[model samples]
Target: MVVTDVSRPDAGSPGTMPVRRKRSRIPGWLRGVIWAVIAIAVISTASYSTGAAALTSSNTASTALRLALPILLCALGGLWAERAGVVNIGLEGMMILGTWGAAWGSYNGGVWAGLVAALAFGALGGLLHAVATVTFNVNHIVSGVAINLLGLGVTKYLANLIFAPVSGNPRQSPVVPKFDTYSASFLSDWLGGLEKEQRVGISDVAGILRGLVTEVAPLTMIAIILIPLSYYILWRTRFGLRLRSCGENPVAAESLGVNVYLHKYVAVVISGAFAGMGGASLVLLRGGADYLENQTNGRGYIGLAAMIFGNWRPGGLLGGAALFGYADGLQLAGGGEAVLALLYGAVILVGVIVVVQLFRRQWIAAGLGVVGAGVLYAIYWSNDTLPSDLIPYTAHFVTLIVLAVASQRLRPPQADGQPYRRGED
Candidate 1:
């Protein structure tokens, strides 16, 4: 009997069975958007409980905006690096260094001097990164790790040496002058009840709105403005073109008459300077430029994630940073333990499921996973003690994870990370 096996196709036979074509899954971008919407809906529903209702006010929203500013600035700084073909992993270190410089400068000179000094030192750090990664051709990741280590050591040493006192009293640096919070002023004007002289309660919706708009410094505005400016520079300007070329294909760009080395240097310097400004903002707004060891608190890394989440676009970074900032703000707003825990776990689980489903495209699996997580959170909340103060932290953590995963699905420009070497393809 001339029975042919249907499963196996003969190598040289004309009657070979055709291979089945695999269908393309949904685009990552579309999946991400859908997941994001789902996650937001889940969070909103979870926050609709009586306890969460008490927490959701104008004040809470304002606080979320206020916290978002510094993160936005840091994300911009990171964006500068990534856009120019370098990954800046040392944002945290740059921030710490800037904080130290700004604090020290403010203590001796003034706030303006502190700001300038911070930028200068930040530029210097960028130069170091440039030299290590671009000029010497070192691994960018290792160089960043080195910078973080150096920043930690140097900032700590300076803080202890300068701030630590031999006597009973420790000498400290002056605080940055408070800038007008336009958001707060506008909110107050719009809300119509808050008095200029009245001490508004933090928990009050009006109070929170007032605090965000009124208390946020002018630097925050600067950070927001940088978003558009950065986009223009990166996509519209000559220098930006050269910078991008170097990162995408240095040899090719170098061959095509672009100064790959110089462009890389400029990119790192710009990135470092922005990161430094972010650090200075912290001191000026919150801690004062006095050396606080590890004051940056991983905002630098968060900034990197923001850049990715924004798909390396300057304008998009603002939203990404704000998401993280909102998380941090939620953690700070102190709520009841059980409520906070439930909220935190739910948000995080939703974020994770959304990210995974977006990447893997297992819609059914993802739905089941999220459902399981919700159940687990319910069980845990029934037995565990949840703290209110940790709400913002939990929120920020969940948001950051979401941003990170979403960013991976984003399609960056073709020439994003290659150095522009002249005459090379």
Candidate 2:
């Protein structure tokens, strides 16, 4: 019948080459969802087994959100500056300035005024950074360190002058107004009932959702909205393109008339403003808006870690902040028992990694994963609770581990931390 076989390209046609079908890769959002699901399952199982209800409780989730807010803001600040080719090592300093400004503003005016003052103070810190690194071409790291010192000294002195009289403490300020929180009308109640059921994964998810919808502060809502807003501005807008180009290649951007210097300046200034807002979050929420000495307590550096873990993206940083905040919140909620439950969770997570590594024929990695899982399980079995002193460092430990794991996948701005000057090719 001489029927032509159309299925095989190379079968009938002369000099035809067979085409290979490309493998479909999972979308980033889908991958994130899968990982989140896996994490939830692991934590939920651990929570049930250990009877550590705090692991999945609404209180813990709420605490995590509260703790994560400042870090998220600071990370966002770092993202803005780095994306525009400026390395903002002075985020801590900007945040410090923000705390003072927030306390002062809140005491004199109100919570809203405090927020505005925080942004202004942070912008001031950013301006100093820009003047040093952008105008004078100072070393980014050096300038950042100097700015940190300056922020600390200036704030301390100001606190003594302004706050000490009323509070009777140089490192403290008078009580300021705090933002009120809101809960979704019916959703919070519905979710709370579902969470009370304690039905494994479903209950765990409900608790998390309940926490999100219940008693959420206005500032928290603002911080959450910034994530998507940042994505749209940086990825979709022309100004964002120019800013990112400056970070990637300032000379190239300048060649294209992108005004690299101006973009860098604006980016750094914005970065400071964000950090300042982070500081404001801490002050306004902590103990009814009272400013305490060293309230930031290295959150600035932690936020920078979150930024790195996120690989310099808004969504990624949010996850990183959430992770650190969760660790911190768990310790605060359930004390040592909660931290112990986390060990069990780690064991399960490591076991999953081992299985994945085995499937990929990664013999060494799988072997290491097995050992890690075994050690973690052993620790979990032996200890009923983690040491009290160690609880405070749980977030830091999480930060180091997460950074180590994610470091290989990170790709920072090409010209990050590099000094740039006009007319210099």
Candidate 3:
């Protein structure tokens, strides 16, 4: 029997390996870029044709970047873990701990101190995960679940003990210091025009660019910088190759004198560090708000989706993050139709009602569809817009559509969740 390198899709299958598609000639990152360009072109054309506002504007671009940063960092963390052949479901746990650490640090020292605490706490969580998965050879998923549970309990308990007495509650912390956001006046004027709030011009490009360059968090700048840095480190460094090899085939790497255990530990720990910083960045963006329980929400899971969508490459991750972030920002941007924001919200609201009623049972669902249609008719009777707060649910649906369509191209590491030992056959 042949012992194949497990990272490749065709590794153990030999003759059964699949052929590539015609479009496979285009790399995944390039494909994503092309699709993005096409999407912008199509949306722009439709907007111009209908005499509507531009699909993209300075406001939406800025908000999307802020939304994308945490998810991008978490996705990068996932990339590191999976590439090293470890399935790290513990990113959520690490992020939770990071939030607590950040709150404590900020409350005592300052925002920068909170950042340090977040990284340290996150690394500690990674260490625990690595010990369970790598050292003891436990199931990766099980280990991750356990870490999440522990993180939840420990953070809450610590928050009560440390912050509750002071803030008078176990669920929240005292406010932390904040970092200043910066703006560029020239970029705002040149790239984002002053008066085309009602029209689409070639100048919309400048608006989007201005949003990207100004009124931004310092951490957002750092996160953007980290994207290129991650790509270079993972693809170009000698240590990275060894780390990837450990994921693909640890036995082969060991045979070639690589330190498989060390690499796995390093990858997991680094992943945790990134996750922790992601939590800190999130809170810092709020600018001195008390850290509350469950603040990370489900962004960690979204990061995993982004990792899959990116085809597990750094550049692809960037594209994936941007797409998801833009989707998230759509509600705020009224789906890029400032005039129709309310109308869109009413339609979406009724659609959600129909879906939920249907999921509860069949007859009730059918009834809801009829009632929903009537409600929809009533809403468009005046074609009036709805409140911005009512439109906040748009991103979840946008995420679903994007994931359903884009996940078709994903290919995960072959032996990602497999167990291995130094002398395994």
Candidate 4:
């Protein structure tokens, strides 16, 4: 009898290749859109059921966008550095320097000058980081910590010397010029009128759109433009490919005649520029026309978290920022009640997860998802209001939960944060 192993059909065939089935899955962008639609539906239902008008209010959306901008910029900064295999834990410090630079320049020149100074100062910070990590080969984390210390100490001394002399406050800078904001006059008016009509889904959509077009700042517009620009430069352009190569494998990149050090230096510098722009946004937009001590208040750290949550992609980073911003905005717009509505939305989201896990035959995960959904639903049913203290930290709590869930799927650069020297095999 001839024994032919069906499972080993290609075992003895050296030149033959196995034909595998191609699995069809949803495109990433389309999946994102589908998830977004589900989230919106859940939140809209929560808003109506709970009578939380602020959940979909235009003012809340505006506040969320304003609050998200700084985080978005900082995350972009981190993305640039990490993509070049340079770990930048000094983003907070760079932002500090930018704030001081913005104040000094705006005081001396104008808001535009302030922005230029911020970028210059931020680039300086990045340069210092590059000198420590890339040139001297210091531990990336240690160098980052030192940069943070240096940024804080240097900015403090400068603030005392420059700001105190003018404002008579060591911790505060003198009044700086504020940037003008634009709104679509007739269109914004029409949207506002439509939103005020309060026609459930239609009104909510109108309200969200109105917020986008109303009182929009030039910097905000520029920041939004940078998202797509960064995507194009980093994913489409040859320079981006070379830079990213340095992060993935410096030795391999150098073998291919790519300038690893130069690319890293450029990336770190651009990182600092983005961080500085974030600081400039605070001073010029929502910071009461002046730089204040600790105005950042850990926003740089939050931006880093946002970056990680996004899995080092610009689009993901934007979503993370928007999520945190919306949570905070809900707290600001309607206090505890609005946030309570988020709990209901969370329940719906978890329920959807349970369904997905079940479909995938992930029995254990589906069970956990069901429990989580049940617990969240119970919380929503029982609590009419979240505690005052907890409400202030709503965004942070949401960030933590999101990071925990997203942690499973992250795929960072292979050589990220690894020390590399030229010609070292």
Candidate 5:
């Protein structure tokens, strides 16, 4: 009998067996199809007259970053909860609580105090989720729902109680101060002739680039720093491993000497803290907090979508958040025209699709995303007139369908929604 050479590759010999190439998981034809679709869409869209304007409007970097920041933070929070065996359906409620806390804190103690209070309150809310789900063994989904309801009701009641209708300034909350702009002297020195201009002189492209890049917001810098730190803490550290293990198989993790309960509690608390900070960022950076019901405005859901789009990765979450932010900026800049609204909707839908698909196949997904964006541009340019109100509704409906279908096929981690249990895999 002849011995097979299967083990020959691992034998201690130099240059004895051929090196096996890693097989490509994605098919070539599929990639080709995706690329083709993207190419066609881009060419068609670019040929249209309004394509330039739409692209320019969509690519405004500052506006996109600002809009994306809160969603990014929220998604990161969700990532933590899910990674640690907790399903946080109550992110919306948490956001409301945070907003209310920040407002109350700012009202009493000022902006700094409001921020600290929001983080603390957010952690408290997380504790609520952990106690109800982890300790009591209640259904995670139900617990989340309950927390959301409690948050909404409590926040509203508190708003009324504190800033009642009797007060003329019922809707108002203390505003946080904005960051200072670059000093005139610094700007003038950096960009020659800027001293003569009101803000920064726009003599050339270099000046414009300097102006755009130089004016860094505090939150923006914070966000950039947090992304890598979050990634490191979640994947590279021992604590992160324990948290993941707990989520994936709580029983096994418990048997391995991991404190499952503590991990779950910590995860939930962190989730809430980030969410609270996000709420504060929205109010402080965007505007002062107000007592409007549902003030978070579906941002929680948006954050959830972002988490899925990001595949629960910190860096990916930031990218997803930025895309959504760009969508928002487009809506703001386009002046609510029917065509513009439709175009914006199309862009968002396409972006979501590309991100989700990219998880399965990077090149194919990239091609498709490019194509989808191009198609949206063409649609905007081809139309001479668009109905404003109907466009947003229509776009929203289309996006909803696309997202629903995409989500159905995208599987989250196996331990995504389970509570960490003590001992036994």
Candidate 6:
């Protein structure tokens, strides 16, 4: 946000600029709506134009939702921690702990118990990070790395000690109960018949609406609700304001008599809770048979990416998560439809860019977009599509491109990594 002068004639320290630049003052709600519309336009054009059966299928939709929920939750976790002035790189470790906690809780109590246990374990991990970075003034990144190492070591050691004996597998745990799925075959058939695992009619708005309601995981439902819930709590409420302020400038918050350390601790602990929820989803998404050492993979890191992509906003986070999830779903479902659909989506984006440029009177930019669209059409006419191997992760490429293009629009807390001490201005 601070724009400084690099060139100065006499430069002990260049005085602050007297001139202030006007900035756009778009409301948050309106910005969200705009983002949603753009996302829908791009996704819709890709889905229908390419005949991406997998993208449209009920199974693909279900899978994407499932995959997106965990990532969204983790992103929310990162949002909480970072927004509170703590850079938490230990989300992966917290998630790993949640896997074991979920397994243990499920084994002892039930599915719900698994969730509670996951939260507890994640909270513990968060606490460790907070104690080191917040209380002791350790470097935040160093503390996070330590937590990750400790979590990995402890989980592996415990798995060998406990899970190996119980399930006869050192790397995996025994099965536990999982959530049930609901069916809507009639709706699918009525919606123009499923092309792969879904009915090939995304623009059939009716079908898409019905599809979301049916065959959904309970956790997915929770995650969807949490999106708006997070937005309301973080951006709408007074307490949320305080929380965000703490991240932006803890010293200023402290001057206002805010319990800076307390708030930071609370933010990080909450962050862990959300991450734990994500871990539970990972286990219970299927038949909760076992917890594997490598289940989390790099999803925790990806979640951080999603948060940045969303500009640290909840709704934006949802879109980013959904985009990533869609890619994974196509890969899981395995088909050519997803690949074709992505190409079509690219074409749609090209058109959108050209239209926006034309409206803005950017003739050169508009012309380039037109040219790009023409090339895409030529490819379509020549019978071309994205490679099958790349279909599964097209979203990653999109995420990177988006981040590059809109980097200026995205901002983090001004004091995100600066250590705060009491009585300091």
* lDDT, candidate 6, 1-425, per-residue tens: 33444354333245545344466798877876786667665665566666554555556666777788778889989999988899988888888888888887887798788889989998999998888888998998898888778878888998899889889988998887776776566775555343333423344344344556677777777878888887888889977888899999888888888898998899999888888788888887663346898688878888988898888888777777877886777667645556555656656766766676677777766776666567656655665555667655654654454434333257889988788888878
TM-score of 2: 0.93
Measured by TM-score, the strongest candidate is: 2
Question: Cα deviation in Å at residue 266, candidate 1?
Answer: 0.9
Better of 2 and 3 by TM-score: 2
Model 5 per-residue lDDT at 55: 28
RMSD for each model, in Å, please?
A: 8.5, 3.1, 9.2, 4.1, 7.2, 8.0
How well does each candidate superpose onto the true structure, as a TM-score?
0.74, 0.93, 0.79, 0.91, 0.74, 0.82
Comparing candidate 4 with candidate 6, which one achieves the higher lDDT? 4
Whole-structure CA lDDT of model 5: 0.65
Clash statistics: count for each candidate: 37, 0, 4, 0, 3, 5
| The candidate that achieves the highest lDDT relative to the unseen native structure | 2
Write down the worst ten-residue block by lDDT for model 2.
399-408
Against the unseen true structure, what C-alpha lDDT does each candidate score? 0.65, 0.86, 0.73, 0.83, 0.65, 0.75
Over the stretch 1-425, how does candidate 1's per-residue lDDT look in tens digits?
23345445563366554455467797645765675455445544444442353233444555566667656767887777776677788777887788878877766677677788788878888889888877676777888899989888877677677756532223334344433344445566765354222323323434444545655556766777788788788879998888777666666677778877777778889888888888787776652334456777788888887777777776567667767765665555534443364455464655576666757786665665566556545645664545555544555545544443343457665655444433435
Error of 4 at 380 (Å): 3.2
Q: For candidate 3, write residues 160-256 as lDDT tens digits.
A: 8999889888899876786678887776676655425544446455556777888777778788888888878888899988998888888888999
Off by over 4 Å in 1: 1-47, 53-55, 165-187, 192-212, 286-290, 336-385, 388-393, 404-408, 412-425
Candidate rank order under TM-score? 2, 4, 6, 3, 1, 5
Stretches of candidate 2 off by over 4 Å are 1-14, 18-22, 286-289, 354-371, 406-408
**TM-score (C-alpha) between model 6 and the true structure:** 0.82
Worst 10 residues of 3 by lDDT: 338-347
Across 1-425, the per-residue lDDT of candidate 4 in tens digits comes to: 23334357554465545554467898766766786777677777778888887878888888888888888999999999999999999998888888899888988998899889988888899999999999989998999888888988999999998889889999999888978889998989998998899887878777777887988888899999998899899989999999999989999999999999999999999999999888888898852447988887787888888888888888888877787778777788778888888777777766776777677777776776666667667877888788999887864564464345333357788888998898997
Q: Model 4's lDDT to the true fold? A: 0.83
